[model samples]
Target: MNESAFQAGAARVDITPPLGTLINGDFITHYARFIHDPLYAKALVLQQGKTTLALVIVDICAMPKDLLDEVKIALQNETGLLPQQVLIASTHTHAAGSVASLLLGAADLPYRQKLPALLIESVKAALQHRRPAKIGFGAVDVPEHVVCRRFFMKEGYQALNPVTGGLDGVKTNPFGDEQQIDRRVAPVDPQVSFLAVKGLDDQWISVLANYSLHYVGDWENGTITADYFGVFSEEIGRLLQAGPGFVGMMSNGTSGEANIWDFLDPDRYPKAHFAKSELIGKDIAGKVANALQAIGWQEAPELSARYTEVAAGVRKPSAEELDAAKKLAAESQYETIQQVDRDALRRIYAREQVLLNDYPDTNLFPVQALQIGTGRIGALGAEFFAETGLKLKQNHQPYFTITMANGYIGYVPPAHEIERGGYETWRCRTSFLEPGAEEAIRTQLVELLKAEAERPVYSSYEIKQYER
Candidate 1:
């Protein structure tokens, strides 16, 4: 158990908006909410020998391709690291900064204009903040808090019910068969993994935590927020901090169909359960803390990295479908719908129209794999279903973490779920890819993992501070 075996650096940038404003969709006309006091972009850099890998965690809703590319290019050029070596992940915060132009409506044009500089500065700060630190990993299961949203209907009658008025005899719960309906699906990785770091004096630096549960606690109002990630970070930092300087960076795991909301069993809906998200966050953080207490430190030796983009096709709506969607969107008035049925109906029509051109029928999915000693990290570009993450971990040797929605290319539903055609699989206004996208990603990932396993071992580099 050597404390000096690894060098670590952590930096946090305040990405808070000027005045908590709504950036996603056409919400400016209706609500007036400011960003809460805290929103951040945090980074963790780990080095073993000449090979260094950097993980950037943003509190934003998601990382669109353009913005992610801009950040990646800037960080690579400045840090002298290959673009593929850096992994940028989002917290999937629905209330955070607007990055998706087509989905969220162009970020306040001014905000979009200034974002690149902010992003650059944040990454630079993280790299500059490197320090001698020790890292330890641990995991725990928090089953009661999260569940798979894709409920299979068992009764044939329920499956036959129409999801929309216009689609006659269309099955609502397409995946539900008489035998499978009502069965609860599990997370790809039900375990929460924590990587704890501390300075030479045993001072806490940051805890890099991973969990596979979707973020949907916040609403579509005009507010600058980090949703559950923000709350989770704040709670963890407060609990672990001996003083200021201590931080917590949360990386979203495979959470595609996994959500705190149990959509299948409507009885579990937390309408009055405001504390549910907080409880889930705090419970996981506590488990991470407990895990950190048990692990012994070991020097991480050797590093390898690679990045590839897999083409996942887009989903397109017909011209007539687009017109209908646009018309429905105009009527919704951005008002909150009380009835689940009405809301579901409106969302179906609205999404079909808006996503018609934006959804990817073919997607160039970015999959980056980085290795540090025996530990391996996999970067998945889309909001991956929990099942996919579980499969990767089960198949890959020495897998450390699987971060989902990294450089987000939208949701990657499981093959069977795609046929069901729900919010995640069908929301894309662009050309939707085939149902096999998840398998394709998993296959490529397995190849990367195998390659990493065969690579030769290396050692950590000596830290030498450079004069500015």
Candidate 2:
């Protein structure tokens, strides 16, 4: 091994605390029911010479962009790493801390202030413990456990055409109309891709697993936990030959409408479903370990990593639209919808329109591309639907992994889903990004991929060059 190759160190900090109350879109509060002991916020640090990159994955519910910005700023100031170099991703756990902005009807300021500090500490500890390591990439398909929760149905409750068939005339757009859809057309992609890094002594240091399946697991009691990602991380740690220090970070993929529990089917809801968070965690971890064994160890050097920000147009609500939303929210049967509408009404009545600026139509979407040897890891800003993810993988050849919903800009449904005018689409009271948002994202990713593919290969020097 070269004496001066890149090194990696990982550390996980338990942030599941004295219970910061949790809430989901359903507006029902729930406490953390520990299916497994202890939830965590994990950090993995990679250093190539002086260029250091730190990735922190939190098992919290959706991470607000502002909070993430704060964490990034603190990391940059503390460790001299650029904001882009310090990638912070949430597991989208509905059972974890309450950090989402209040406009979406979820706001807990006390916990939100403390979260960034906790995350920063986790990253600092990981960077402090950096050591020489080897990284390998592998993936496995495990689609059976996950399914798309949103579906299209006619007014009479008959199945509508699927959007995957090029969106010609799908009757319902799941993203646009929040109220009418009764069933989903298909399940989301459930492939779990991972990057395994181990120390020179063969101790597993960090395992970054990316999967597309929203976590709506047994979450009904306002408890602070890591949801399925935490369970998966714990399982991976137990399976690792290394000590408890083995860090596993599960980054959610394109799962805007996908979840372990089928919301439309009450049988699959949290209380009735047989697929526990622990089981989901264990299954993915085992599959990752299995893939690791078959592939063995390979030295992967950081070829190139770049970050870009695109202005994603948000759908703005007009005075009439706001009035209509307030009316619907006041009369809606769902408490969650009512709460959001009531809040919006209060703001409108108080002339507190400035608050809406924070929730504007155009959002700064961050897209990050990291090339490890020949593999690529793409991070998107929004909760992209599965079709967008699959398209990115298909167009970008040799894409080792593509993770969406990293920043969680609500949901980016396919054009057809947008036209179906369902909850995800209608809830956006901001800019109407053309139906081609998915295509635009894919195009940008392809551009990045082409650049990375043209870059020189670095692994050839680490091992005897072998052609695949």
Candidate 3:
């Protein structure tokens, strides 16, 4: 149609860790005892005229900047794509292998060592397989699947801060005592935004979807799975009657404060392990399949990307606090922070404080925006809140966010939410970004999206009329 110049390709490489690899995301370390399902680094390469952009979604908890920066350099050396032209993100599945150290769960050094080559392989394969393609954008709202994990407790209920040994106004992931919960502290985002790509012959290529549900973690411990993200890939392919080449990727959105656990109505989900995740994955796939039928395909939609690093402060431990932490950490009977119990949170947080004391006072986190077809996707290097994602969508229509992209900078709650004091706002390496980080990240991303929208490719009279 109308002299098309777009091309696309998709490929996936197994990145599943071997048995005995340590998995992060929880307070304690859990080793991979079995392969419940294989993990992967799925890549999609897009080209329009002389410009090319790549997106890779990996099945893991999180990857720090140092690790990903090395991967980016290798990719650039082999493919000539700049760091800003590539957008790599994690699915944030707690069941996968550790690539970044969080809490007491250390990075699996051997597993991390093997990751770069696999990631590079996926991208190179996708680049070699590029074909003439058409792309479309679609979204659906499935509010029933998302629930805000943070809540305001009733009077006299203590929401303890492990770092300070004091009371917090809000609690996260509270269960059993639902009556003590006054109301949800924040709202959840349920929008499932997707980019659907197909070859000129009408053959399926890939579907890249985004949603804000943090993760569906229902599998047993010591198992390696991609959580619901991998299941969605399978279910979507089956529903669409897609061939083996079809790639279905579900990237995590601003899900720092969202999850599938409905504490107010615990019975709403299945009680069996792995069943809830399967149900959610299939249900979400069904929604995507239904929406796919209505998309308006574009044979030659423009492709562009913008990336920048925004300055954000880190909540490093103060000298006085570090001194106290040293004293408590030394007195603890546990060998590692992972061995500390619920009653010994002071010891666990002390270790986090000592670790954070080595961090810089301010760091630069990446913010990226990509324009594919009529869809706008924003990428952030941290776990952000649902409100931030919703605000971005409201400001820029047909736009969605992909979190834990490029690098990991920890959780970024809104300043107001940080003041409320939940587990996500506690002083730890996982939640060390300053309260103002959200606002700064949001402001930068919005400007980036605006710049992409104003690019010359969409400046023509015919294109302007079609955009409306």
Each model's TM-score, in the order given? 0.80, 0.80, 0.95
Q: In angstroms, how far off is 77's CA in candidate 2?
A: 1.7
Instruction: Give the alpha carbon lDDT tens digit for every residue of 140-188 in model 2.
Output: 9998678876665556543322111122223323434445665566557
- Scored by lDDT, model 1 comes in at 0.63
lDDT string for model 1 (1-468, tens) is 233356677778887766544455331221227654467878777766566677778776656666776666666667776566777887776666566543324455555566667766766776676667766666777676677765544445343211233322113233324245556544346777766777767887778778887774635356666666766677778777645776687778887767766545545544543355566677777777666677766445566776666766565666776776777777774445434364545554475556556644566677777776656778887677777877788875446454544466567777777665555665453215667778987888777777843342221110111111
List ranges where model 3 is wrong by over 4 Å.
1-4, 336-340, 452-468
RMSD score of candidate 3 (Å) = 5.5
Rank ordering of all candidates by lDDT, starting from the highest: 3, 2, 1
Kindly give the number of clashing pairs for every candidate: 41, 35, 0
User: Distance (Å) between predicted and true CA of 360, model 1?
Assistant: 7.5
Judge candidate 1 at residue 307 and give its lDDT: 64
- Global Cα lDDT for candidate 3: 0.87
Of the candidates shown, which would achieve the greatest TM-score relative to the real structure?
3
RMSD of 1: 6.5
TM-score of 2: 0.80
Cα lDDT of model 2 overall? 0.63
